[model samples]
Target: MGTPAISGDPKPQITFQTKGITKVYDTGDVQVHALRGVDLALYEGEFAVLLGPSGSGKSTLLNILGGLDQPTDGQVWFRNQELTAASERELTRYRRDNVGFVFQFYNLVPSLTARENVELVTEIARSPMDAREALDIVGLKERVDHFPAQLSGGEQQRVAIARAIAKRPDVLLCDEPTGALDSQTGVIVLEAIERVNAELGTTTAVITHNASIADMAHRVVSFADGAIARVVVNDARKPARDITW
Candidate 1:
């Protein structure tokens, strides 16, 4: 795909921009402040890793960017389009056409084969790659006919990845994608994500508590106490295969 409008020279196009974003959830008698005055931008085609402790706003920020949740305050933009001002229906369409998501759980239908699971998304997409091609991208072409029950946990996660990217989304957001797997399995999942970012140039952002995973990102955003604590640009990125616990 071609690049979006350039925000400036000498930098990749900005995919997401958030200004003073805040989110507060009311649980009857109590209120939880999730994000507080977070201002950040994710660059096009750059792989970013979000690192923070639990309840530190990393996931909250990601959810807002992915259009899964709306913030209580501040402004957010997908390229030049303002997401904070979008209607719910528009947000739904935006997510469907532009964003791809992967979570800790595989969420594959038990009875569906790996290719069939990925086909669920491709069937509804405007212009999608062949389901088998998507599976191939994640190194699962051989297992395309295998049911979820027949695959290992890592293989299942790769199928989830294939489902997400089958639509050729502009941005891929991963939330604790490898959280449920062992180190070896986590590495495999990470490699799939890395391949998607590198091969397809899908702008990618991952939420990971594992600090070692930061080496695989072009930049790392660290959150603390519902705000951004620091942002680091990696001088050189290490492949997921070289990343060890």
Candidate 2:
């Protein structure tokens, strides 16, 4: 399938853009292509869901957009900055100042309370929200003092969401935020992510294999064989609470 054209009046601001980007992993005697000439644009304050099976390049694209990995060829732009040309120091700074990341696992410190775990990011952030405020946004105000071990799986994921957004990043990238949870718990976690995008106007991109989650996004990009196979613009988006599996 061809790349779908995006249509909008007074075109929305593009938060991230990639042109013909490709990624290749070189093993001892073989080369594995993770992305094959991908071209995509994510708009400001828009919630986008990337849907694909394993090794379809969704996570690889997310990592490159988050500055955790570099594409082997082509170019990437974050607003007006060309990330493909940035040095390692610049990339690190970009990731620190502009991006927020959430993964499947809750990487909270075992010994730190929820608030303390969030405080670690706020302490070094350029301008951060109070740890308590971050927790409140994720519906964990009452559990701020609890450690990760004390919270339920969904609650722990919410705390992870809080930590990622405590810095008030311009973009939020999540790789399978609910992959480890049951349907009910996953819905709660999705609600927290939906809230962040709605409340903070953060440009959010979520990578998921669950097709139902696509119903909650402004745009759904489907990947196949390391390339985008289709893009559907959702005019009637459902709330994350309505999603299942």
Candidate 1 lDDT, tens digit per residue, 82-186? 999999999999999999999999999998999999999999899999999999999998999999999999999999999999999999999999999999999
Query: Candidate 2's residue-wise lDDT over 1-245, tens digit each?
Result: 22222334346788899999999999979999999999999988889999999999999999999999999999999999999999999999999899999999999998999999999999989999999999999999999999999999999999999999999999999999999999999999999999999889899999999999999988899999999999998878899888976
- Alpha-carbon lDDT, every model: 0.91, 0.93
lDDT accuracy of residue 233 in candidate 1: 76
Candidate with top lDDT is 2
Cα RMSD, each candidate: 3.4, 2.2
TM-score top scorer: 2
Q: Please report how far candidate 2 places residue 115 from its true position, in Å.
A: 0.1
TM-score of model 2 (CA atoms): 0.96
Q: After superposition, how far is residue 85 of candidate 2 from its true place, in Å?
A: 0.6
